[model samples]
Target: MIEYHSLREASPEQTIAWMEVLAENLRPSDLDEIAATSDMDPLLSLTTSVMLSDMAWVITSNDIPVAVFGCAPAGPAGSGLVWMMGTPLMDERRTAISIARSTVPYLRQMHQRYACLWNHIDARNEKSMKWLRWSGFRLLEAVPDYGREGRLFFIFARYDPDV
Candidate 1:
């Protein structure tokens, strides 16, 4: 069964293994985020840091970690960011569709508090860009040399001024 697991329930080793799976899908920009020093540190830091400020959920299938999803403030008082990273699965197409649909309600709730929600996706990750577009985020601009290795990234945003 697929379900959301809290980060608190994961052991250190399990978390590291999940990070390794996530690293396998990263774009060059993601790899450069940690100076290529270690794959585990960046994600570990992200999961831990976000746990305090926002919601963190581990997506699992039959108790196996398949993905991690969460939301956090975007530094600006009324802005926020949402993110997700996942491991490869045999049937990713179905999994992706399920995740996209399941997260909409959560994203909508986040919109009630944060006037703007956004993400910075590596420009080279076409699949992600397309997915974000499908999920209602608009591409704002391309940021050149945005990450450690001078990788380019695209800023995607969804706003609700009424919020």
Candidate 2:
């Protein structure tokens, strides 16, 4: 079974361990964008989520982390940026799918306050793009020279106009 937990439910050390795993396993195509987005330190990104996210969840299966996702306010009136880190889905397909399924409801709940929640996906990360589309986000635009290292990225979003 997949379980969701608050950051307080797991020690900071445990979360950092997950972040380390995510960092070590990032695909070469994703590495530069992730570093640019997260300020070059994956641990800092997770730690920031723990501190600033209005909504966050760590998804685990059989006591092992499958993924962690968080949403934090971004300017532009009730908009937020959504972020996620996970173990390689290819290695844990079932667990990753379970986590992906759970993320939709969590995201819907965030829609209560966030008019739009978006993620910047590396243009070369086709796997992530596929998953994001399946999870209900629209591919809004392709941004050229979007990152610190001049990589391209796509902006994907789920928007609630009523917010």
Candidate 3:
């Protein structure tokens, strides 16, 4: 079963530990390399603090983190950005799909004013792209040179005008 909850539920040390795992899963400790080529905000620790305190959502299965996602609110009248998604607990596609579906309702609950949600989806993450599609996000545009390092990225959005 997947659970969505606050960061306070876990210790700070545990959160930091999650970051270590996330770093390894995503880059092999090579964020410096990615950062060098792009504008890596890397505010995850701070972001997670904000989410746990108030802005993001953390997803776990069997008490282990499967994913975490948060975003800056959409200005006063607009929808917010889908800031980030942390490590996947396993390469099991169904698990990722489950975690993502469980997460969307939380997002809608968190931001009711937003008509559209957007993300600067990294071009290199094809695996993530597949899972994101399963979760309801749609590819909107390819914004070339969007990152600080001049790399291209996809702008994805998911919205319900009725909501």
Candidate 4:
């Protein structure tokens, strides 16, 4: 069974332990993005992201963490930067399907507090881009030199009209 838990329920050590394994199996695009954007190693990057997020959740399958995702305050008021990182276990068809179905509703809930949810996705991450489009996020311009390593990236966003 898959279970979702608030990050608050997870201890720092537990989060780190899960992240250490997840980092090793992170999607290639995620590994590349991290390499381009920060000096931190995969474990550090994943841990830091969790720590900075205002609201986050851990997805566990049968007690083993499979993913961590959440949103952080962006520069403007009512704007947030959304992000997700998961282990290869999430690639299982059943798990992927379930998470995909839940995504839109999760974003809608986030929209209650954030008028705009945005993030930069590595251009090579076609799977993520497709998922974002399916989730109703608009894919804006692509930046040729986006990160410290000067790789390509696309800006993606979803806006709440009611806000």
Candidate 5:
């Protein structure tokens, strides 16, 4: 069974692990926002200085961490930002539905506040775009990255299903 485990007070080891996976997928400028692994003091100082204005979680099963996801904590489901999402390390574990479903409550709660909760998908990440669409988020637009090369991204926003 997959479970949502909060990392509200993540240890240095956990934070570094999360940063390692996320850094691999981020742009150079984005990478500069936090310190490098060799110098993790800034990250830990920044991370624990506040209660993570939002939230971060890891999906684990059988005592091993498989996937990591984070977002702002308030509002309807799906309203917060999804900072990073990585492919699960387990071969048999597939959590697409649950991963997508996790944002439901946030989407509904924050629907009226913003046009919709948005996420950016790398232009080359067709699988992620398809997964978001399958999860019920509609494509809004493709935005060009001003700072990076070949980093065009598709912005997807979550919508109401009951309507």
Candidate 6:
């Protein structure tokens, strides 16, 4: 069974287990992006991201974590910077489709108090860029020299002026 749990609710043992899986199975694009932006190892990166997020969730399938995702407040009030990282299990066809469909609702919940939700995606991650567009985020511009390694990245955002 698939379940969603608040990141806060994860036990230390569970966190370690998830970290191990993610360390071994994180997508290449995710690994590249993290390496470009920080010196922290995958485990530390995952832990730090979850800690900094204002609202984050863990998606588990039969008790194994498949993904962790959330958003943190960004500069300028009512704006949020969102992110997601997942293990290879998330790429299973059915799981992928379900996760894609669920993203909008999760973003809606996360953006309830924010006017805009935005983030940067590695330019090489075409799958994620397509998914973001499908979820209604507009791709703004590409940064040719983004992050520590100067890899290309594209800024994407979803705006709700009424919020």
Alpha carbon lDDT of each predicted model: 0.67, 0.74, 0.61, 0.83, 0.52, 0.83
Q: Report model 3's TM-score to 2 decimal places.
A: 0.71
The lDDT, on a scale of 0 to 1, for candidate 2 is 0.74
Which regions of candidate 3 deviate over 4 angstroms? 8-21, 24-54, 88-90
Highest TM-score scorer: 4
- List candidate 2 stretches off by more than 4 Å: 8-30, 36-39, 89-91
Clashes of each: 0, 0, 3, 0, 10, 0
As for TM-score, the candidate ahead, 1 or 5, is 1
The TM-scores of all predictions, comma-separated, are 0.75, 0.83, 0.71, 0.92, 0.57, 0.91
Which residue pairs of candidate 6 clash?
none
Query: What does candidate 4's lDDT look like per residue over 26-136, in tens digits?
Result: 877778888887788888888888888887887888887777888988868999999988877777888877778876767887888899999999988877787788888
Superposed on all Cα atoms, the candidates' RMSDs to the truth, in angstroms, are 3.8, 2.5, 3.9, 1.5, 6.6, 1.6
Candidate 2 lDDT over 64-94, as tens digits, reads 6656778989868889988776656433677
* TM-score between candidate 4 and the true structure: 0.92
For candidate 3, give the lDDT of residue 156: 86
Task: Give the per-residue lDDT of model 6 (tens digit) for 63-140.
Answer: 877888889898689999888888777778888788888777788887797889998889888777877888889999
TM-score of 5: 0.57
lDDT of 2 at 21: 64
lDDT of 1 by residue, 1-163 (tens): 6676656576767766765665565444444444432344656645554464466667777766666767788768888887765666413788777776776776787788888888777776666666678778999998887755576777889888889
Model 5, residue 129: distance off in Å is 1.4
Off by over 4 Å in 1: 6-43
Between candidates 4 and 5, which one is better according to TM-score? Answer: 4
| Model 3 whole-model lDDT (C-alpha atoms) | 0.61
Stretches of candidate 4 exceeding 4 Å from the true structure: none
